[model samples]
Target: MSVVAVLRLPLAVDLSGFVKLLQRMQVPHRVSEEAGEQVLWVPDEISEDVRSLYARFPAGDPDQQLELPASGRTSTRPGFVQQLKASPITALVLLSSLIVAAVTLLGENLETLRWLTFLEFRVVGDYIQFTPLGDSLAAGQWWRLVTPMLVHFGFLHIAMNGMWYWELGRRIEARQGGINLLGLTLLFSLVSNFAQYVFSGATLFGGLSGVLYGLLGHCWIYQLLAPNPAYHLPRGVLVMMLVWLLLCLSGLVSLIGFGEIANAAHVGGLLVGCFTGLLGGLFARRKMAL
Candidate 1:
């Protein structure tokens, strides 16, 4: 676990391309600020290779071509932040979630909650009554279908979802483009929210867990079929999430005081995401062939 500095660069110079290169090469690394400069650290064993790569970085040779492992062509892609800015869909989804969570924290505010939730329901003594807000949808308040994805119930809920969304959504946006990520988010949210409503039987439930599961599923399947560095995920993460899903569905989470789990939403999101990933992966493979 000993990490050593492999390369040092001035702060003004962008390191995103270099970082992406390392990621593509499956090299473990960490970047830290030191002495008014950025230091790239890697395992001691890979330090020399990293140093050698830096010595002949593509920036130094305008005429030389940079060939990625799988592809023979060079890519003149911008850095990560610049790419994110160019495609703001992921940022929009993340910001919407944060804003919704903040507004929810203002108070119990039943009116606001009803507006944001996928479907409003009320308990009628022995039976649960459901209302699907037909008027709102007819009035072009179509945001209701997807708004539930942003309705985080607590601080931890929002924080976890935000982190996952930032990580997964950014990766998707960077590789597949903003529109693809936006479409996937919308599809996942719609399916998961509706599934939750159907299974939970007019109960109040809201969070991004379902969408996060969809992202996870998409990444997992895409990495499997496409085998790209951008979609890489640690095996442990996949195992942990799958185990947690099983635990939730098994009713163990509720017994353990984890509160109500949206098992159906998670299932629905994962299924839809897997389907999307399958289609996307096949298309990518065909495009590469072309």
Candidate 2:
């Protein structure tokens, strides 16, 4: 049996130390086309033997890297700094903070620029009044297709979505590379978000929520179907999502209020994401078979 460890290396490598790792582990390995990544094959028969040897890896494959913002005090302690540099946790924290700051500073204007969390169809009244021009554009509006997603109604909305994107995006960027992540996000955003406005006859649309949820759904679905998602999602995530749905049903959470999780967009994005993941997995399998 073998457990494969895929590593997305830091910008800088401690060559001497990596050599020591290969010697210590006595395992076979291959470097990726880019010096930034590697794949290590580990022996299945082991009792936590790989923990120290493998903790250096970002996390899982395709989209698994450190949690971001690689934290804690790293040292001259050979190999220590190397691992910290690859942490996704540190990167995520920094990105979240930056987005929060930008959202906070943008003040009210953030709303007009991009849709935050709630879908345009969810908050139809306020949005319609807010963007009357969107009305003229609504009758078979083509530009709204892309513009709506860029318009957010609130600061937190952008922060939440942006933060997730920076973190998860980096991982997926590491995996399928930036091109695919960007492509998928754009595809899901345009297709699902636009579908909702069209279905509800919504003249005005706003927020990153639809796309945010789409990205989340994409990550969750891919992880579930693809073998791993960095770390497994706790039962808590499921319950939290359900509770959010219930809140939408109860009208307690606004966008998520009164069946407003863009149940349509949510379903559409989710279905798309699930199928995308399945399809992506098939591609991986075929590539392996080849």
Name the candidate that leads on lDDT.
1
How well does each candidate superpose onto the true structure, as a TM-score?
A: 0.68, 0.54
* Residue 92 in candidate 2, Cα distance off native in Å: 14
CA-lDDT, candidates in order: 0.78, 0.50
- lDDT per residue (tens digit) for residues 1-290 in model 1: 77777666799988877777777766799999999999888876455456656755734333335544454556566677865685598889878887876777722565567777766655578664657668667767788788888887767777888888888898788677788899899899999988997887667777778888898899888777766667888899889899999999999998998778899999999999898888888876554332
Candidate 2 at residue 272, lDDT? 76
Best by TM-score: 1
For candidate 2, the per-residue lDDT at 14 reads 37
Kindly state the number of residue pairs that clash in model 1: 0
For candidate 2, write residues 114-223 as lDDT tens digits.
34422322335555333343654564445545444555435665566555555555555444545676677667767777667656553444444555556556666665
Candidate 1 — which pairs collide? none
